[model samples]
Target: MFSDILCVILFCTLHFIASSSELQPGMPNVCADQEMSMLGARQPCVQAFTRMVKVWKQGCNSHRWCMGYERRTAYYTVYRQVYNMDTHTVYKCCPGWRQDGKEMGCLHRVCSANTCFNGGQCAETGDKICQCPLGFKGTQCQYDVNECERDEGGCEGFCCNTIGSFYCKCPEGSRLGPDGRVCHDVNECEELNGGCQQTCVDTPGSHHCECNEGFRMHSDGRTCIAVNSCSVLNGGCEHKCVDTGNNNYKCECRKNYQLKRDGRHCEYTRVHCSCRPGFTLAADGKNCEGIEMEIVNSCEKINGGCSHHCEHTTNGPLCSCNHGYQLALDRKTYSDECVSGGACCRHFCRNYPGGYECSCRAGHRLNPDGCGCDDVDECLAETSGCEHDCVNTLGTYECFCELGFRLDQDQHSCIYLLFRKVPQLLQYTAALHSRYVSDEDDSDGGDREVEIQRGRRGELRLSSSIVCLDGSFGDDCSVSCEDCDHGVCSENRDQCECAAGWTGIICNKTCSQGTYGPACNSLCRCQNGGSCDPVTGKCVCPPGVQGLLCEDGCPRGHFGMHCRRKCNCPNNGHCHRLYGGCLCSPGLYGRLCHLCEYQ
Candidate 1:
């Protein structure tokens, strides 16, 4: 029985040991320390503490914890309760081990508690913070992303936000593009041409109506109407325009007019003119008149007989004299009676039945008016007539010979100037006489030869005579002088003698202050402090004077004599009778100042 009791005691002791080995309440399956002794199996405890520190460093909850022993104590207690086991005396866990609700293993380094939503991520930070994705907001990312709030999702037209996404929309006439953000215009005209009658133009959001060629749009802007070409200024016709249907027209000209090349204008076919005698038909053979015809034998007409010679005039005929003749007292008979005593002929005269004929010597001809004679240009007419040179005079021409020759009396021939050296002999004789006189005191032998030469020179010089022509006077017949003012020059002398009231050698000087005219014989008749023009003999009066002489004041209504004048103009007008002009006041005009301009 004692042996049986010993066996039972031993079995009871083994059962107690086995029960102690089993995990108890508040105790982990693996223990780092035994009896809470650091020296016994302290490695497992150190390892477990190190793992807890690591988990705390990572984060105890989705919300970050404060970094302090006091703040971490609560987290440490919770972590210890969640991960370690209680042995009725101490709490412990295995080395490098942790517990996270139904899972026991190594420490989890992340602080994620399913707090973030909609693709958001919870960050392992000191505080509970959610890193939301794009377009998301709020603490736990519970709100949908509002992409439209920021930038309208980069939409071109309109934006619409919905549950973490966005969409773009367009207007009525536009549609969204492939990019889902841009808008494109919808061309309604492209389909059935917008149901237009003629043409339709597509606009940005709508369309418009138009017309085709030669057609205009109606007021409704949809229907097309036929254009009326004739409605525009009668088709731009000069005469009558007739429409020929279908926007076409034709121009019709009036009487005596025809259409021009442009088919729209009209031009007169007949030209009219004033019919008059002596006018011929025009080149166009129309009603116009042309140049006048020439009249002939006008003296044969009635009341057109001329006493001497009949000459045709523009109006009719007239009497005239023949060449080299003059009309008599009857004004019809030509005769030479004027040349007998009237001094009509300049050179020669001849008598005729009805007129007097005047003739000029050779190298002269009658003037155009048949009053005087003029020298003929013989050199120009007959260039070969002279041997060397030709000189013309009043009634004759002279031919000049060369230096060794002379002109003959016939005036057209040249002769040698024989004995030309005779004048040179006189010069030699004087030189010889001077030398003889100078040497006389030294020797008198050369005196006799010099005296003989001097006597011969004097004889030859005396025999030769230098005769001056009729209008010329001088030792060599070379000097000439014109008659004095209004006075004739004497043929024998070259002196100038002025006429009455005239002076100066060349007869060019006029009379003194009180005389004027050809011979300056007229006396001045100026009055009222007036002066005379020396050449014109007209009076120059002072201010306030008029007439031939300045002897009167300005006329009534006339002012400064320089410009202002009197006026008898009507309708409050002014007139300048001196200039035959009239100036009417405002609203009135005309030569007589009787017309109203505005009216």
Candidate 2:
């Protein structure tokens, strides 16, 4: 029953649509060929044809009356043609009008009423009606189908409805596709990256902007800017912080400080203290003090806990013996039972506080090895009793006079010999003769020669000769001498005298050790194991040492020749004294001026 009802409802809806289509004035004819032929014959057609004609006439009457007098006359002319067709008169219809059958009923030709709207076509049926095109509805297609209400008009973005038509639209950053109903990404970035400051990316129906590494987008979402890593907390550095590229930073410390394990804080590298022995660190950890004081004080509080007196020293506490008591082998104990036999002392042994002292007799002194005694040399000491020469003995000294002199009542004084004046005169005469010989030798040798002699009265006498031979001197040409090394020979004197600094008669000896200069009278002052040049009096210093006396060491950045030569070392390097080449620092090589090995 329900199926029948549903079928009836469907058939009724279809019938309504068909009836509505026929209501238009341009509908096509619905009559069959037999009915059309019977209408054209002299006898009338079936009743159904008459009913259909009556309906057409009623529609025409109503349209004519409503359209005014002019349309009514035109309708009447068509009605008369139809009525006259019953009389079998052979007549023609007006232009754009035609007969439905061969002899009677009249109707409009195809689309004769011009009643269709929006490009709809008009056709002839029993009555004229409009045939609407796609996207249109109603008798004249005056209304538009609302495509937007049905699935968004097949548009990817927006839709708009219009009379007899509809169109699709797109939002910003989007465009309509070739289908004319769907939207696609506009690709605004295709032209100059969408005018973005860095990067641009396309999305569904829109476009967005981005930035590259080490940069961030601005508030406008299009511009980019570099990141500043040091702006916050100075990159967590305690002393100094430097910003590198790509938002990175490094930390550094001040002089005398080093970076801590955290890589942010600084720590002191040097502390203030005197590095003394028997000392320990103080509470502050930066100073030092003697620990012996504390130990001594503690020991003193316990009275040293020794069998003798306690003494405080820098080394702590010590046990001492009392008078008449000897320190035992244990050293910490004193014993009065031990008596001295004087065997340990070479002289008089006297007992003193804590130990025994040795005393020497007159003219003798005690040695540092307390058990021995040494003689005091009065001759070398300033307190000698003698005024002149003093001779040292085992335990005493004696005064004496030199040769040709005698001691007075005061044994320290001296007296000259009785014939001293005669000898003095002889010595003076000999000196005068030597001068005369030297003067004569300076003159060019002529045909004469001179000889010198001493008379009985201690006076000098000279003799001359007419001829003199080579290597011989004197008036008789009798004196002779051999050639002298490092010396000049005096032709007149026939003698060789050594030059300065040459002591031997033949000038064969050089200056002795520890002496230099003209006459070998100057003493060497060279120090620090330096050697003095015999001729120049200059000192030659050893390696790593320089200066006149070799007293100064080679300072940094300098070496050789009194430390006057500058070093060519680079990168905090040192140099060798013998060779001026550079010694590079750790991890560096190749003349010290090149790049590091790692680099």
Top candidate (TM-score): 2
TM-score of 2: 0.21
> Which stretch of 10 consecutive residues in model 1 shows the poorest summed lDDT?
426-435
lDDT of each: 0.55, 0.55
Across residues 37-119, which tens digit of lDDT does each residue of candidate 2 receive? 22332433322211111122334554743322222211111111122222222234444445553423346554545667878
TM-score of each: 0.19, 0.21
Worst 10 residues of 2 by lDDT: 423-432
Score candidate 2 by lDDT: 0.55
Tens digits of per-residue lDDT for model 1, 1-599: 99999999999999987666444445543454446322222222122133223223336467566343332222122212124434435434443234554333323333356757788777656444677777678867778877887777799888999887778988867889898988899896775345355567999977887875546754334445447655555655668978764334578999999986656567789747544334565766656554656666666774254545866665456666667656555444443454335646666664444555677877667877575665565654775378766543333445666454544434456666444123221111112122123332213443444344323222111112344444443233332363243566755556445565464443546677777665676788886446677667788754345688654544323433543433333322334425525645457667765688878
For model 2, what is the error of residue 119's alpha carbon versus the real structure, in angstroms, after optimal superposition?
Answer: 3.4
lDDT, residue 186, candidate 1: 82
